[model samples]
Target: MDKDASGPKVVVGVDGSESSYAALRWAVRYAGLVGGTVDAVSVWELPGRYGWSAPAVDMDVDEEEARRRMRQELTDVLGTDAAESVRTHVVHGNPADVLLRAAEGAEVLVVGSRGRGGFARVLLGSVGQHVAQHAGCPVVIVRSGPS
Candidate 1:
C-alpha cells in the first residue's frame, strides 16, 4: 500500500453512470476540502451466467479509453482541475469485490446508490449495496436527491 503523509486517500467507485458521476463529484469535493487525493475506480465484470459457450467480446477495451472518457465526463460536470485530481483505475472483477479491495487503505469509500442498470426501479444496485456493507473504511452512498 502506498502511504502518503500529505492526506488521506479517497476512493470512489465510478461506472460512467449519472449516479456514479455524482459520487465521483462528491468525492472530489470532499478530497479537496480534506487535502487528499481521489482515486477513481471502474470495474468491468464478465457476465457469469454466460458459461463457456458465450462468445468473448472485447473485454480488454483500452484502459486509457475508459480513463479518458471518465475524465471527460467529470470535467464536464466539475471542471478540469476536478478531473485532474482524479487518478483513474480500471480493473476486471466483480464490481463489489474490486471496490472493497480498493477501499482497504482508503480513508473514505464513495459509491452511487444506483448506476446504469437496465431496471430503472432498482433502488440500489448490487455493487452499491455490497460496498456499503463490506467496505473496510467509511462509505458514503450518494443518492440522487437534495444533499
Candidate 2:
C-alpha cells in the first residue's frame, strides 16, 4: 500500500459468479484510484468424487481450456482494456491458497462474499473466509451488485 511503488498491484479472486464480477469491478475501480494493475485469478479443480470413485479411470481435464474460459470472462467483464492493466490466470488448486499466493506482494486482495460453491445457503464462501482470515495483505469482500 505504498505510494512510491511502481503502481499498486491488486489481486482479485473470481469464479464467474455475480459476486465475483462485482469484486472484479470493485478491484478495478480501486486500482484506478491507486494507479495499479490487477491480477484476476480464477480457480478450478476436479470434482471431489473423481479421485474417490475411480482411481483407475483417467479423467480428462483440459487446463488450457479452463484458462481460455477465464481469459474470456476477464475480457467480458473488464472489456478489451484488460490487456493494459489486468492479467487473468486460471489455476488448478484451492482458491484461497492460490489467491493468497498471488497476493504475496500485492497491496490488497479482493473477493466476493460468495461464489459458486455447493453451500449456496451460506453467507460467505469458504474461500473468501479463508483469504480474509489468512491473507498477508488487506482483504476486501464485495457482495453481488444490484440485480
Candidate 3:
C-alpha cells in the first residue's frame, strides 16, 4: 500500500552484511525511481543454544544497540538526503519472520542473498529464500554481483 501521495512503500531487510548493504543501495535507488519511501528493518535474535553458562541479562539493551548501529550504517550508506526518505526499524526476533511481517503491507520486499549465516549454499541464503517464498509482496533478492 502507498504510505504517501508519491507511491507505494518498500521494505528492505538489513543485517549489516555486504550483500544486505548492496540490497539497501538498490532499494534506495529503486525508491528514488518509483517515488516511495523505504523501511529499513534490522532483526536480532538471541542465540538458540549458548554454552553451559548463565543466561545473559540486559540482552534487550544489546539488541537495541545493534539496531541503532544498523540504522546509522544504513543512513551513512544512503547519505542524508536519500536516508531522510527512509524509516528505520529494529525488531528482536527471527530475521525471516520479521521481514515477512514487514512485507505484509509493502508493495515490494528487498533482501540480500546472504547475511551472517554460515550456510554452505552457493546461491541464495536461507533467510532470503524463506522470505522470497513466503512474503506477501514481490521479493527482490539482491546478489553481491553486478546488476
Best by lDDT: 2
Stretches off by above 4 angstroms in model 2 are 1-5, 48-57
lDDT of 2 by residue, 18-79 (tens): 89999999999999999888888888766563344644444787888887888778778878
- Candidate 3 runs further than 4 Å off: 1-6, 49-60
TM value for model 1:
0.84
Clashing pairs in 2: none
Per-residue CA lDDT of model 1 for 63-92, tens digit only, reads: 778767877877886788768777778887
lDDT of candidate model 2 versus the reference:
0.83
State the RMSD for candidate 3. Answer: 3.8
The local distance difference test score of each candidate is 0.81, 0.83, 0.80
RMSD of 1: 2.9
**Per-residue lDDT of 1-147 in model 3, one digit per residue for the tens?**
234434778899998777898899999889888887788888876765234265744544576677668767977888777777778888877888889888777879999989877774557888999998898889999987653
Instruction: RMSD for all candidates, in order, please.
Output: 2.9, 3.8, 3.8
How does model 3 fare in lDDT? 0.80
Error of 2 at 8 (Å): 1.4
- What TM-score would each prediction reach against the true structure? 0.84, 0.84, 0.82
